[model samples]
Target: MRILIAGAGIAGLTTALSLHAAGLDEIRLVDAAPEIRPLGAGINLLPNAVRELADLGLDAAVGAAAVPTTELVYFSRHGDVIWREPRGRAAGHRWPQLSVHRGHLQMVLLAAAEERLGRGCVRADARVTDFCRLPTGRVRVTLAHRTGDTSTTTEVDALIGADGIRSGVRRVLFPDEGPPVWQRQVVWRGITKIPPFADGRSMFVGGDSTWKVVAYPIAPLPDAAGLVDTNWAVSRTFVPGEVVDRAGWDRVVDPAKLLAALDGWVFDSLDVGALIAAAAPFEQAMVDRDPLPRWTFGPVTLVGDAAHAMCPMGSNGTTQAIIDARALASAVAVEPDISTAFVAYERDRRERMTLLQNCNRALGPEVVVAMADRARSVIRPGPSARDLDRELAEISRRYAELGGFDVAAANAASSYSVRRRPHSARPAQQPAGS
Candidate 1:
């Protein structure tokens, strides 16, 4: 079957790989970008995502570019430790959680897709305008070049919109849905050189209202330096009806304002002020969205951010997209009828995706504030280690259960036996600078 996938980001690339693995041929993937470049900052790969990557034989490539996160440390505004717990392999999961630059992840996926699927399978610089279903059951996709000098049309057995939050296909299918509902939160993220604090793999710190930060080491510095290239995001609630200044997307922020937001927050050991200061002129924003009821329409379906773009609170965006790619691919492999395959994919994914979206929204505020409160009193010097351990264990268990990682299903879907080894072998190297 010939398939047209829109967007070349994580979702789109994964979709291509999954379909190919399912024995589908004649795949055409398109992206609006004139050329693929390293974009975005950093991403946390949960165990579920790691399993999918492992299935694709890209685990080593991803691991080489990532810092194996050992623990998640929660803090209060005053630099108090609220809670800390092991992550990924250390947390008893079979797979390890990874922290890596978003660009690095995208590049890894793109390179793998292009190499295995062939260059002709992926197309960049083509922006899909819309798609229409033919009476004969085939789908016709219309695309135009941003340069305004070129246009093309393609007929495919199916279409998948992995186009991201501002997806054109979604608007075309659900016009009455209007614009995405803002979750009243703005976020800013960037990467910078910084010395590793505590365990280098730790994520989340400085839980406080108005200001909070999630930080992790993405890759080691290039010179084998002690400092790791860290990534972080700071977010706050947006005022009602505030007009977002598009020009200010990359605006530098005042360190004082950023620090003041966490003034009395009590989290863990990390210095909130020092970290924010280190993240000078931080990129900022208010962003999030309400859940969508459906992600599939006829033969065209949505995946990843396009289907359910929520706040980055729960490291589920990328994981959900990867899962979607696998699930949709599996459905198509089983159901010969394109329409039946699309319907089956949506029926299985929409509920889970919606649940994840709601979970992220519910956890957003607590991530920044609850940990702050816990940090205020939990990490004091000379505390009872037994008591602290118990508290930390409870928090870890609660979060693990609430995170919606269906261990049974994840394990079943993540059978590595189904994956083929890469054609070329390479030695595993330490993250950039080690």
Candidate 2:
């Protein structure tokens, strides 16, 4: 079936790749960016996402570009250890949790998509402006090209909106849904070349609900100075009545300001302040929208952040998008019609993504840090250390299960890949390199 995907970011590109694997090869991806550049900070790919990549024959390439995180540790504001657990393969999962630069990961996916979907499959400086469901059971999509004072249109069997939080398709679907709802927090993110800490392959989160610092090594190896490229993020919830500069949310801020905000966040091995001070940082308001009742609308549908933009409380945003691509592609391959495929895809994904949206809003596994902080209070009798650990472990376990990354579940889960249908629309085209 002919398909047009809006936004060539991770979600859209992955969707194209997944569709190609499922024998639905007539696809095109249009992006709003003037050019595809390697940009952005680090992102963590939990084992579930990695497993999908493995099925797509991309595991080795992505693993080579990332550091396979071995563990995750939580610390109180005072630097006291709250809880610690193994991760990825160390946690006995079939795949590894990968930490890589966000831009690098996108480029990796883009390369794979181009090789498999043909070089002409993606176009830059073009974006989806609007769409209409034609009577012929197809969707006619309008595209606004950046080059000329012109616009173009095309009809496709299906249209997938993989654009991010401020998706144009989403805007058309819910024109009244204004800007994304801010989560009342401002985050500063950056990467720095620093001497590896804590086994050099682990991630850590410190502080409480109001504020926290997270850091992990995103590079697979240290440089000549024995320093690894590390990614760090510092976030603070806004105080009541504090003014928010929404217009300046995407601006780059001075590292000194970040250091000031994270003052005194020093640990025995990790110094949050020092990390921020050493890197150039970009700041943004942590924002997401309420989950919609449905993501499929006739011949059109949404995926990734467009479908359910959730806070990154548990590092499941990217993973969920990858999963969405797989599920949607699998449905398209097996379902008889585009509308049926979209419905099946939505049925399979909507409930779980909605749960994740609420879960992240509640801080997901990071809730453990706040729980530990409360337990450490001297104002009243706190839960015993043993009891606290049990509770914290349970919270983490629930979140893992909720996010579809539970070790047992992920390892034993059926594959998302699908066999090419016997009655495909046409024979698969030769991949670019092949």
Candidate 3:
């Protein structure tokens, strides 16, 4: 079936790969960005997604561009440990979880798409302005050019809106819904070349619900001073009625402000002040849309942030999108009717994503830390700490289970076997996005 995928970021690109592997290649990808460029900071590929990528034969490409995270640790605002868990292969998952620069991961997926789907099959400077069902039982998507007032339209058997939070396709479908809704939370994201924190492959989260910082190494450990690029983010809660303009906020912000918000967040390993001083931070309002009742609308459906944008609480955004692509492709591969595939895909994904959205809104497993922090003054040591630890660990395990990726189950599941791509084959294409 001919398909048009909106947005060439992770979700759109991964969808292309999944469809291609399923023996369908009449897929076209487009992004609003004039050209694909390395954008954003670090992203996590949970074992479930790692398995999906391995199935598509891009594990080596991703491995070369990213670091395999070994463990995750959480700390309270006072720097007390809340929870720690092994990740990926370390956690016994068949596939290792990867933390990589978002742009780098996109480029890796882009190269694979171009190599397998043909170069330029993924277009830049194209934006889907609107889409609708056609008389011929197909979907027609309209594109507004970036450089001109000109626009183009195409008809396909199906359309996948893998476009991100500010998705035009979503706007057309829900004009009344408006832009992404933001809570009273604002987050500042930045990366720095600094001394590696903790284990070179570890990721850490410190602080409570109202304020927090997530830091992780985006690349392999450095050779010398142990300096590597580390991605860091700090989020603060604001007044509920606070106003934040989405268009006005670029990824860049003053580092001093971020440093101020994290004034006391000095841990033994991660130096919050030093990292923030390394560079400016990109400011963003912590926002998400209320989960929709259905993502399937005839031959059109949504994926990734477009489908269900959530808080960064659990770091589940990209993983959920990858799984969405996997399920959609699997559905399409087995179902003869594109419409039926849309139903199956949504059926398999919507409820899970909805649960994820709720979990994130309530701060997922991390909420326990905030609760513990508030009760710390009255709560004594000993059993109190042990009980909180037990609760946090269960929350962590429950999130993985809720997301359909129980760590142990993921490790034990027999992975799909695909022929290894020859080492002598073409090297990874460094697109203009590079």
Q: Which pairs clash (backbone N, Cα, C closer than 3 Å) in model 3?
A: 36-433, 251-282
Say which prediction, candidate 1 or candidate 2, comes out ahead on TM-score: 2
- What ranking emerges by TM-score with the best candidate at the front? 2, 3, 1
Q: For model 1, how does the per-residue alpha-carbon lDDT over 182-240 read when each residue is reduced to its tens digit?
A: 66666776676767766667776555555567888788434367777878777775557
Cand. 1 Cα-lDDT? 0.71
In order, how many clashes per candidate? 19, 0, 2
Give the winner by lDDT.
2
The segments of candidate 2 whose C-alpha lies over 4 angstroms from its true place after superposition are 243-248, 377-383, 425-434
Poorest stretch of ten by lDDT in candidate 2? 425-434
Residue 371 displacement (Å), model 1: 6.8
lDDT of model 2 at position 84: 89
Worst 10 residues of 3 by lDDT: 425-434
TM-scores, each model vs. reference: 0.85, 0.94, 0.91
Candidate 3 global TM-score:
0.91
